[model samples]
Target: MADLSVNFAGISSPNPFWLASGPLTNTGYQVMKAFDMGWGGAVWKTVGEPVINVSSRLAAIDYGGRRMMGLNNIELISDRPIDDNLREIAEVKRRFPHHAVIVSLMLASDPTLWSDMMRRVEDTGADGVELNFGCPHGMSERGMGSVVGQVPEYSQQITAYAKSGSSLPVIVKLTPNVTDVRMPARAAVAGGADALSLINTINSVMGLDVETWLPDPHVADRGSHGGYCGPAVKPIGLYMVSALANDRRVPVPLCGIGGIETWRDAVEYLLLGAGAVQVCTAAMHYGFRIIDDLTEGLNDYLDRKGLASVQDLVGKAKHRVGDWNDLRLSYSYKTVAEIHADQCIGCNLCFVACDDGGHQCIDRLPGQRAPVVRKDDCVGCNLCSLVCPVPGCIEMQDIDLGLVETWRQRQSRVGF
Candidate 1:
């Protein structure tokens, strides 16, 4: 059997699957349950001075009928007392020394506080520490999370402080709201962080009450921006991790996060060079048992691929990712939209998409420009094809530039 064990930051995990620090891993009870259920590791929820959470702290939105495709939360760090968390951490470590128990921390902006917390957390005999640098709401407003993560300097300084204070290795969780992901990853490395985990939930507003026209999970007449995480954020998170991994200078073990709901999602992260993968929203949505899919699915996939270990798959896809300019210009794809005239109800989604998105390829009725794609103008970009909920409304005609001198003339030849 292919071993799924992963060695990250010198801490070996039974598998690459890990529980991201969030509401799902808030209590020792939750952490113990997750470890029992097959997750290789768990980053305990952000802990600081105990703070009560709002009554309606979480909200969710579904995509394509998938319950909880995206989630939002205004919750702060661990509501459990700091002393209690430390005690549980000690006990959890005593029980499962082989599993990774990285205590996630959020505290005052001062270096002294971070230093003290790092020392205290290290006392628990936890394998490592993950600085919670990317919660976009509550704690962020208090200047303890994303506020610090957004600045490379602060991220670097705090990471350095934690490194100096803790005997255990440190992984800094990064915020994805920044313009470029490379900056902070590099900064963490500069500060001597042993590894990097990302991305924390993005800033988001859950939804609006159709009646009052206010955001839901509504607070008294108002709602604050919450951290957005779920299946939706996975792709974005993967991109950032890949970008950082691709950078030759920063090879810190990456704790991939975002929308990791299944084994397939976890594989993509590992193949993108993540030393391990983490999940929060999905666990919260599906319960700790979700790890059943996370582990079995990955193991099945590895077996099918004839691989013996998770390490074999890690970074297998990294080299395949390249700069936009290096993309094969020769790879030409035409728009292919299926029009289900019966189901379309003449919504004009395809027509509007073809017209506004790119070329006016889609043409409509004789009098009303119903948006039928003009085969000639359609670059086959597929924009029109995708919007046609009616199925195959506007289809892009595949163009082999070899058959047409157009692209050759557009590029190699200039108007003299």
Candidate 2:
């Protein structure tokens, strides 16, 4: 059996699935309940100066019968008293000594406040402290949250303050709002961060209600832009995580967040260089019981892959990610769509898609129910495969062109 345990940036946990800082992790009851259900760790909801959150705090986008394909929220940090949060943190850690209990924190820009908060959190006997610089909604307006995360200088300065004030490991949670995520990632590392977690929710406005002529999750007749997250954001999260993972300057363990719902999603993060993964929307959608499947599925996957432990899976695919310029030119390599005729449902969805939206490579013969792929014209865009309802009906077959040259190589050859 593979060992599911992990020691991430000095914070040991029984596994790599930790509940992200959100509504689900807002209380000791919730965190303890989640741990009992098999979660490895929990980052307690961000604690700072308490603020009253508005009603109708959440909005979601559903697609194809999947609820919350993406979730958006105008929610702020924990509204509970700081003293109450601290007491619960100490109690939870004391009870679940082996589990990772990381307290997420945000504060005014004052260095003294950061230093003091760090000391107070450390006294709770928690395994680590995560600087909550990634909340993208209400907190940003207050000069905290993404305000600090967006600027590399502030990221470094605050991380330094947190590190100086406590002996506990400091993990900087980064926002994805910037043009390049690596900037703040490197800054956090430069400030003595033991690890990094990304990406926090994206800046977005969910949608507008046409009937009422109001934005989604409206507070009466008004709505504000909120942080966006969920399965829909998985691709963005993967790109950002891999970007940091492949970079040589940001040398620190990563805790991947955003759009991770299942063991497969968690595995993708691990392979892309995350030491652990954080879940928010999924847990909120499915409940804490989902942890059982998360652990079991991961354990089974590790065993099937012949891996000894979860750590062995981390960064295994890092080398596969590279700049687009490094990709082989089309003349050097290519793939064409191959439609399995026997399996085709004759839906012509592929044909419609290829003709209308993609390259006009798929043709429907007069006498045949299945469409034929004009392989020579097929650009291997995979649009046909995506539109096909049947799995494995359309396969992209690689064609070895007996040549190998990247864009950079071609540029060099042409002396451009």
Index of the highest-lDDT prediction: 2
Q: Write the per-residue lDDT of candidate 1 for residues 305-352, one digit (tens) a residue.
A: 999999899889987776764443433423344454544567777677
Query: Each prediction's Cα lDDT score?
Result: 0.82, 0.93
Any idea what lDDT model 2 has? 0.93
Candidate 1 achieves a global lDDT of 0.82
RMSD of 1: 4.2
The positional error of residue 15 in candidate 1, measured at the CA in angstroms, is 1.0
lDDT of 2 at 257: 94
Worst 10 residues of 2 by lDDT: 204-213
RMSD of each: 4.2, 1.0
